[model samples]
Target: MNLEEKLKQLPNDAGVYQYFDKDGHLLYIGKAKVLKNRVKSYFKFTPKLLPADKLSPRIYKMITEVESLEWIVVPNEHDALILENSLIKQLKPKYNILLRDDKTYPYIYINLNEDFPRLEITRKVLKEKNIKYFGPYSIGARDMLDSIYEIVPLVQKKSCIKGKEACLFHQINKCHAPCEGKITKEDYAKLVDEALGFIYNKNKLVTKLNSKMEEYSADFRFEEAMKLRDRIKSIKKSQIQTGMDLATNENLDLFAIKAINNKAVLVRMFFRDGKLASSNHNYIKQNKDDINIDINEAYSRAIVNYYDNELPLLPSEILIADEIEEKRDIEEFIKQKFSKSISILNPKRGKKKEIIQVAHNNCDELLRLQNTSSETSLYEDLKLLFNLEKTPNRFECFDNSHMMGQATVGAMVTWEEKFVKSDFRHYNLEAKDEYAQMRETLMRRVESFEKNPAPDMWVIDGGETLLKLARDIRDSCGVNLDIVAIAKEKLDFKAHRAKGSAKDIIFYERAGEILKLELLPSDKRLQFIQRLRDEAHRFAITFHKKQKRKEDTQISLLQIKGIGEAKVKKLLLYFGTFDNIKNANLKELKEILNEKDAMLLLNYFKNLEG
Candidate 1:
């Protein structure tokens, strides 16, 4: 449809909308308080407001598919919020902040049913259970058990400390000493109720406590009033001094986005009840754009995409670093989605705005941690470490095995990136030779690659002879490829020889010295090659064992009486296959056997042979 025609048809209402490519693939999913107004704004805006100026070329790919737009109308802003979250997850729109990590933060769960009411940290949110959870906090050094040390006494609950009078907390009138039976079950239940209220409704609890302190002081209960004052101070001290203050709602989500030279860091600070749950900062790696674009639009896309995929527990409010163009729409959408009217505030002064500034400071610290590491990308390291002109995107390794040149077999393994392709080949030699077996295996590998060209590097698990054979096969098959070899010390296969450790294996390329790769012990490329070599060795040995078992069984049958010399040779020649002898009937065998020896041979065949 034409831009004007589409805009005229759109309804001015709250809803979720999907933007699709020419091929009908969903590019982005978003919600707006006024569906008609929001959808129309895109086409109406000048070239300066185009997404092409801000997002990278990778993102621009989605813009070509703007052939059609679809919308799902909802009753209110919050309904739009819920629908947007559900649709984005189902469709997994391309132009969105993908949830990179699949992990949940831990929350401290208090089992209200338990007599002692133990507190434990859990990853699951078991909503069906009658339990209270607080703080999806950091998996930091301070264990959740440590919370019990202060929490148990703070609530004046029963403890296991026995055969003693009231503890100092109770003597000082801070605790009711339920362990010593000084407090009744009814009174203790009241304390439990207060604790639960404080956990889930921190701001309200603190407000009530403050009021109680004021009333007690007015009644001249100085000692009682002083205790409440200290308790309030203690709770405040536990929180991160982010300088963020909310009037009645302590549970809030604060987001701060900073853009410097087109790069951005998004800081999300989560507050639970009244305590600091955790703060997470994510940096967007965007190349500096040629056209200077509005930073606010970039920030808006970042936040929307993040929340769309994550859909973390909706907070009572969101504090942004700056004003966004779709501020009203985002606020209404969030409030409806969370089933609570949440404020989207840009605080001018006081604790709320300070919280955003604190989030910004935390952003600086996050950048330091991410960029300081000297570790190289795994693929790049592999390419340099192996000294290959091209990266080892598809690498092949080979190994040979035999029991004293008997039942010889060769195996070829392939590595693509960091993964070993297990479905490769293990071939029987047919000829009783190691060099010939290596030649046959290499020939097969080259031929296979020729038929199905997976143009890449090769890693042979032998020295000069094997490497040369592999190259010859590549030439014969007319398959040009890069190749390397890892040869173990000759003594590695000797009988009664000590087993070789990692240090014993020498990594040899076609052109370089066969040195211990251990010199570059820290190199990721060498480590990857070592794993491939180990895998090739394992495959070759396993195939060789099966070949040996079959050959040994056939050779063992040659020793029986009347199954000797010419007769045995005749039987072997007539059977043509070893498996036939295993299944041959007595009558069928009698025709091949001499008459006098037929009976003896039948008895031998019926009985188990060595």
Candidate 2:
């Protein structure tokens, strides 16, 4: 629709709005409390009250080029704030501030789906069902893990169920030997809960440690008492300090922002027990037209995103360096998600204000250093653009090839940053159906995980049907690998005719929800995936042809003079039935096959296509 028509129909509620250029390229994305009022303000202003010169030159250019407008209405401003962030990342509009980070901290994760769960260290935390993740402790993540292991007596090896005998760890009391039935699952579960409680609540941890120290003294074990005493003191001293005057028992998250030369930097200082526990900073690349945007809008957008998608952790209080546009909206969202009360404040005085300044100062140094590395940034872009958990450094592309349900074969090509020919493999299939071929192929490929584990991701050369098979294989094998599917826009299978060119359909996922992306031919990601898929196709087709060549000898018709295996097979197929060819007279067969071939084929009971 035209701009005027779209504007007249704009909703009067909070929502995210988009401005598109004549070419249908997204120019800008924004969140507004009242979509109608906010959108109208852009073009409705007269030169007298609101001077045209007051607007940023970049905005003026964007406004005139805007041929169409679209909006998605949400329940409240917080929903608009969230929708806007997701769209900005997905579309990467020309006129918006892009805030992202290349580095992610390590977190201790527990996968509760296993019969005996395993605790592992991971830098990436995904929102999957039945999995718990803790800590982004920057400097001492290893030490934190070690501390928990010592207190919990959990499994220290890859598989506790495998080591039937009490290993060294169990002998030294580092593990409770669940495999040997020395500890019940119920008892072991309590120890795991206690370790998790210590990580989440410090007061309870200190109290429990203190009680242990007293018990050791009453038992007359002075050496153990001294050790327990030192542990208690160390726990108390490990408390973080933020140089703030507020009470040290409450938890808070302090946010600060700074913008310069149209680029912006945001800093978030996490406070637990009213002390700085961890901090994060990200620089935002702003579009030229973004000069007209206010810092308050940025803060509002940042607040919604940081709490909702970026971190799983939460605090009772959230302090901002400046007032944001929709404080009530943000508070409401936080309350609903956490199911508890939350206070969002803009401090005017006291220590809360001082911490804001400290965060702001950190942004200045960040801008000076410009420490964003290029290699890491590329992977971040790939992850966001492709919707992946890890940077796909190694990926495999799979494809199946067949000719008339004969000589069916499946091929998988490995790519480590680029093609790795030595790691490529082909599977001979027994299934005649195409979809069945895919399932069997994937089952065999994943079975190899016993000897060689799966790649970072698998790129299948088909649609969601093939992707589902890949996912099933991964779950059954207990392998952790991401799946991507690439298919053609059209499927044409005319023999001896060139396959028409079509755009690739890329299937990606975010938090297990699959999304389809169609990029232009010139897009780099599309080209890269095409190369991987094409290699797999080439490998499969080449093997299928080789299989057909080998089978040609079994017919024994290829040894005949002036007659080939291909011509003989085609003549047999043209007939309604292959058995008719064996009984046909020379005169009857010459009409379909050549005279010399008719003599040769009449002598041989041709066994092939009907």
Candidate 3:
């Protein structure tokens, strides 16, 4: 239907409304209590009645591109709010305040369903029964995890039980080895609870680290003491600072935003059971295609998007830095998303106001640090793009190179903050088919956990099929590794009917499905993934060429039955060459070889050496 005809049919019920451009690209997603009244407001305005300045530049521009309108009728505004947020994340429309991030905050998870639950780190906060999750720490998540492992004698590796016998880790007391029945499930449950206690009471872990540092110093182990001191510093740096407590055991979240030079930063602080647990900060920027956003509007957009799209702890009270226009509307959203009452308040005075002020101060300092640097950290962009659990410190890229089925090889290049040529790995493959080659390559790579720990992320050169094989290898070997695949650039440029040209694309898991990056050639994401694919291809091709060169000159002596390198060496040493060995009789061959070897070799070369 056309714009006017569709607008005439708007229902009185609440719902999410979407505006689309002539070309069908989404312009905006919005929620309304009364669909007819809100949707009709746009047509009611005229250039003379509402001047350009009175209508926000953003709204004005959005209206210009809006050639058609569509909406869903819902029972209440709360449902509309959630639907709108989901649509925004799913479509990523041009006019929405896209909540781009530098990193995905990490949360400490302990699955209570398992008999012996161990603490682990993750980025996704899923809603599941018996899966208890702790802080979404902004920094030092690894340090915190390492600190917890020091005091907790729990399962350390994902694939801990390799065989019937206890491994060295159990012998060294690092693991209780529940796989081998060293500790009862009940006893391990107690240790898990102790570890959870440490998570709540982080001070205990800090104290233990301090004591270890002092012991090392007293023993004149300065190197060990220094390492301990660094760990302590990381814990302190990443921990949430104290603020004016509400003096109640209520769970709540306080948000404070600071806007400068048309840019904004929103700081979210968590308070559970009257304790300040942790806080996270993110910057808000206007898309180049969209109009600039005001600080007040940005605050509203963040509140709706944060809770509706990114599922966080449902707080009883949500305090804001300033009065927002959609305060009651947001409260309705929280009520529906989480079946509980929420107070979206702008406190004027007292302890609650002080909490808001603290959050504001945090943004001020964070903005300063952000501006001092020329750009955000490289790892930060990757974390947000791929939705990884942490700033990926260790990046390993895999590529398989071969001409047909001969001289097959697999290459892995490592990058830790920076590329490390010294750590590059090359593998010779035995499989003839592509899928088998990938499976065998990955199986051999992750089979040895003690030799090489799992990296934060693995980039493979192929599509979803190859990436799935990598995941299977990880699961069978019991490792927590993140695997993503980059599709090679299409030889035909017309494949880019939408993105302008053929470019290498990255495939990563988001909201359960594998998502292909909608990237352009000039985009930083395209450049970053292209570099990894190129490096892997270069290493694999180099290794394949070397293997082919060696194979070209050598005879297929290794293929002979019952004749290995030692037997071949003895024959050559006695007869001078392979030709000479082929001219020898069984009596002459038996002089240098054992009976079994001589008979097998003589039978194979009967016509030449009989």
- Candidate 1 vs 2: which has more lDDT: 2
* Best candidate (score: lDDT): 3
The residue-level lDDT of candidate 3 at 476 comes to: 60
Total clashing pairs for each candidate: 7, 0, 0
- The 0-to-1 C-alpha lDDT of every candidate, in the order given, reads 0.61, 0.70, 0.73
> Model 2, range 1-610, lDDT digits (tens) per residue?
5677787898889999988877665778988989999887778545322214444665666687788888898998867866776666545466554444323456667877755565677865456778876655544445445556656788887866687788888878888887888888788788778777776665566676677667878899889778766666555544343455456656777778887765577887767655555566666654333454567667766776666543555677889888876788778877776677788998888787787777777877776665454433544566668765345556788999988987899999997545766578999999998789989899887666533445667899888777877777766654446788988764454222235565678876665667788888887677877888899999999999988765654455566666676776776676655456555779988887778778776665444333
lDDT of 1 by residue, 14-101 (tens): 9988886665556677788898977765552463224444444544544545767778888887677667755543344545432221
Give the C-alpha miss distance for residue 523 in model 3, angstroms.
15
Best by TM-score: 3
Tens digit per residue, CA lDDT, model 3, 359-456: 88788888787667533456567777787644455678988888867789998898754576756888899988878888877777776433344566
Ten-residue stretch with the least lDDT total in model 3: 44-53
Candidates by TM-score, descending order: 3, 2, 1
> Model 2, stretches more than 4 Å misplaced?
9-14, 45-61, 73-79, 101-143, 146-165, 171-246, 287-293, 310-312, 371-610
Clashing pairs in 3: none
